[model samples]
Target: MPHLLPDTGPQRTLAASNFTYTVGSGLFLTAGVLYFTQAVHLPAAQVGLGLGIAGFFSLAVGIAVGRLADTRGARGVYATTLVIQALATACFIGADSFWPFVLAVCTATAAKAAGLAARSPLIRHYGGDRPQEFRGYLRAVTNVGISLGALLAGWIVQVGTLTAYQLLIIGNAIAFAASAAILVLLPPVEPEPAVDSPRWIALRDRPYLVLTVLDGVMAIQFKVLTVAIPLWIVEATTAPPWLISGTMLLNTVLVIALQVRAGRNVDSPVAGAGAYRRSGMAFLLSCALVSLSAGTPAWAAGTLLLTAVLIHTIGELWHSAAGFEVSFGLAPKHATGQYLGVFGLGAGLAEALGPALLISACITWGRPGWYVVGALFAVTGLAAPLAVRWAQRRQQAGKGHTASRQPPRRICQTSPP
Candidate 1:
């Protein structure tokens, strides 16, 4: 735990910012939907539709915003996103109708996505020699903060009052504002030296795009614990329904305790690809365990489900670490934000589409679906190394071309969240 602490002032500041941001995220994630459906008295379908529309719109905003961050400045752009997110969240209380709800959600979601891309440069600059490792530390901090916020949200949900939910909204907004405020403590990070490249090079980079698609597919595994596992426990397995919360608690604890440790050794792009393969295999095994729990006795079912969650969480750590390495290690220094923004498109799509895909494959289709999903992950994992190698080769080719024109310098920047 001591080793996991951020060593530098910048790292500490960034970690503090991440912690505050995720705490607010946890609050909203745990209870925001309920606030809309119950406190706002909006229809559930309308809320879902609005969120879906917002998610779709956000996918297109990240690249442009990220490019803005690169040209203008990361800290300012990032702070702007946080302020916009705060404002949009505060507007939630005023959203009575579907259109107003859509407006607020769309603005907030776009800001959130844009913030992630905009902050990439800061992570790269402050992360020192191994930004991926610092990302792991931040992930650990994020899990801890989110867990605390979730506990608070649980109280709000238990209170079950309009005022309590409204308070949750206000608290969430304050958290975002506070997160932005913390960023002021860190020194500003200037944009990297510009390179001669295409206006939208990330979009044109086929190998990187291939890697992005593969990573996006693997990202579906993220929804398994949040969406499929809980639904499976209730609809299929005879495990006590209480295990749903228990499983989530277990996952949170493991992530907070072990995320940095698990990612410590996966330091390079090649290593990250290997981690992806290992993660896929772990997910496959966990899925099998989950599928077997369906027809078991209560105790046996509970055991299998718990075991599955443990394996799944481990895979999640590896998957996250791999993504950080490959995304950061492969991006050009000058276009870190734009490349990461492009990288985010895949995850954005997965976030929007993963739940439906998981439901259809893991729940609607039953046990066979779990196997199908597992196999898909395994195959995706198997393919990652190849994609990474292709990216490496392309990177080398670009480096060679650049060297012919001028003195050689490190072109592949190594950092991002």
Candidate 2:
């Protein structure tokens, strides 16, 4: 358990909002497909197409939405997106056909994307000093909420009724609406006056962009575990399918236990970069251990896979921890929302493409594929420190920070989480 929950009002509000929203997400994730197929009569192909379009649309518009947040305030725009989310999800009630379902998916997804792009910046702006530490608390709370919500959804799934499904969908909409209300309670973040940085500054900052890509590569651990590992257990390893559950359980527990601790002391860009490097090594070790499982006896393979999961989760925790620091630290304070929006692109792309990449490497290459994945992680991990340094230097150069000049950051600026 967390030693203590968030202490400040903003922290509490954000945490409650996240918990509420995720619970609804849990219910929807568990049962949405059934509603789409059986209740709405939408074909799987149409659903996939809609989701694909939504994903692209979200990525394309993310920066524009974030720009709007920075120009006005995240509070209003973020809350508006929440309302949009509520309306779109509730729109599911009327979506009994293909076109309606498609529109609903697109609208809901776009709102989610805009909300996601704004979220970190909102936390950074609203959470007082030590926002990163509070962020750690929020991360743990998010997991707890998701676990609870998913458990609740499991009960509804057992009911197997259209009413139960509708309840889940409606509850999601209500949750969004409620969260929007909570967000409305927050004080508005002041828009930076006369921030002259062009909208494309995020793209111009090549080093920061590179760090984002590397972070995306590290994030592939999630997809690899979810998609590749199960297949490996069934096809390549001698371990029984139950080992999959065991590994997953271990991952969740370790993350819940260690994520906050992993984030500790990584408040600075250099420290965060080092943590990213360590995460890469952990990923490498995890991959090596997982690869060793393939040819082992059932007992040994189980042990190896379990160990791999532990290391993988450790990498995941640290990666997330460092990600917050670097992403916030590297961003221009005036354009934080836009930069964060762009930063999210890498993860979005990875999530979209990870399965194909992992399957091709891990399955097609068989034993060697795991090794290749490890090497890829190692390469990316090693690059993190250099990229971070380059970003720091770039920022220094941008602000004309030399030996005799003012430091890069403002003296009055709040420290990053």
Candidate 3:
């Protein structure tokens, strides 16, 4: 049996971290289900548009809040954002009209983005040098929470009406509030600011820019798998609706089961680069598998979809684990939030563009649209090994430069907290 508790640090801190992530995931999953339910009542294009709007707002506000966390301390920012998220969740419950729903989604998106920005940096703060493992553990715990939320929502939908959606929104509010309370119990650790750390100026850094771009390319898969795949299954196959739900459950279960081991393996000096390379390759393979759906017989399409989902879930695990480690490792201590916020921009853009891209591809290529997505993934995947090599050389050069110019500094004891 897998151990429920992490082996590092004080149990209190680990428990608190797990609790906070659980709450955050619950909010996200709940909001996502509610958003889809609302979207079902509107036109197809409207769904994409609404999500795009939310992503845009989230990207804009998340950057600002990330800067705040870097300068002011993550605890304060996390607590404040969680409060905002709770309010936004409550707003969703009250939102009956289209405009109201839009407004609520926008607010919730921003709140969640900001909260995540603050929370991620804090996780590193607490994990110190071993952030890779800590982040992996964090992801696993959060995935468990997300899985629970998804499962609960599914059950509620079966036994209840749309009103169950309201209850989920309310539950999300409570979860955010609970996270805020937990964050309050942690000690404050303020990060120093970088010189001339304006948001636009930060973008001028080449390495950061490259990482962001790479991440953006990866984001396309995220958006499609999460949104378009379910729709495709429903429209093109005889798969039971629960197949999609099962796929998600499988993803969460795998993360929870293997994330710690994956994190450790990925962080090894010999395997780290290989792990990064494989993430992209796995993603491409999964996309290709999904594309095969276009050629599947109707009688066999359900099995094909299930198989595709399994491949995609494995890709998710590899990419997500590596992505977190790389993001945290590449960031400078003083600019954690700023860099992370920029990293998050890729996700925002993906969420905004993924649905539109899928729709456009379908219109232009019909069933072969899946192939187009697969081709994109393949190209990106092929670039991964090259990117990893570049990042490694850059890090080595940076280390050499820093060693050559030994600056006077106080004794530093670096641990998560």
Candidate 4:
């Protein structure tokens, strides 16, 4: 079968750019906090607090950048942010104190926010016909690139020297620069023409707002693997420490294999809603498996943990499929950049605060935390369909009003003989 974006020059360019940049990101992101605390000799609490705050504040910048993309063209916005990100990411090496580190991280965070704001709209524009599926292929390709970079980073970390860490940082910074060069080589994408006053329409959109907030909640499921799973494995479950690596590998493999296929069937908001519903159920089951690992025998616990990872991977695939659909489908066509920027808030918030929330739930509350989080996903997923329907109705009603306000065309009258 033909690939979704096969033989299309711009789409391939987009995919290549995504892969290149993700590889750069994976190198630094996999060990950012560790580098800050261990190599820089900063206090762990300060480092965590700094990054958490930087990430949180970065959320607000997305909308502003989105506006820029809408007015200034996604290609230019994307390229500019890539260069800013490259510089910011490299500056991490110069920060020896809390304030400097905070400044560098915040700059990188802001650049990242803007890059995301531009990337989606660019994809939507270049996707031509099927945007969501194009996004899925991008996700799969990006994951593969990230996996390769992570492998390289892991090997560098094994070298166990400050120089190696510096090398990793420098390498990632260069990769960002390379990605920007690729974007520069591509043909430019023109900005959408101004429609009415160029204000933030996404803010005024209530149903879209509600749906985005729900996506924020559901996205926390990802944090379970990144932040919670390893901690839980050591503290609660009897699974071996090495199983943590295994679980991460499993997730990467599953996403690369299944993401495109999972998104293949999603053509409408309704289908997207169903995808979310399925994702919710998978999350619920995964959490249940995870909870049951506590107090079990080592063998049983290991089995339970792997099973949980498998189910969680399935949920991740479904969630990605739905996320793209809901974001694009709900957006007003003229204001895709702004709407996507607003939608990016949900994901940004999840990354910013999910660790604390997951820790409180899983560590402070124990197995019941998993249950609570699972139920949260279920509820959010269940609400998705209704929210999408509500937003769709608003679109229809607006179209109807526009039609009603237009003057009727006069028919020619026949002359009497």
- Clash count per candidate: 0, 1, 4, 0
Model 2, runs deviating above 4 Å:
1-4, 38-41, 401-417
**Top lDDT hit:** 1
lDDT of 3 by residue, 319-396 (tens): 666677677776767777777887788777877777689767743456677766767766665665566667667768
**lDDT of every predicted structure (CA atoms):** 0.92, 0.81, 0.68, 0.87
- Displacement of residue 187 (Cα, Å) in model 3 is 2.0
The 10-residue segment with the lowest total lDDT in model 2: 401-410
Clashes of 2: 1
Model 1 segments beyond 4 Å from truth?
A: 1-4, 407-417
Residue 39 CA error for candidate 2 (Å)?
Answer: 4.7
Tens-place lDDT per residue, model 2, 1-417, is 545367777777888888788777777766777778766678888876777777776775668788888888888888888899999999998988778877888899889888877776678876676567667777777677766777877787788788887888888899889988988667778877755456677878899889989988888878877788998999898999988768766776777677777787887999988888888898888888888898889999998998888888888888888888898888877787888888888887787778789889887788888888988888888999999999998888877643545456757877899
- In candidate 4, position 200 carries an lDDT of 83
The reply for model 4, stretches above 4 Å from the true place, is 1-5, 410-417
Clashing pairs for model 1 are none
Q: Determine which window of 10 residues in candidate 3 has minimal summed lDDT.
A: 268-277
Q: TM-score of every model?
A: 0.96, 0.90, 0.83, 0.96
Question: What count of clashes does model 4 give?
Answer: 0
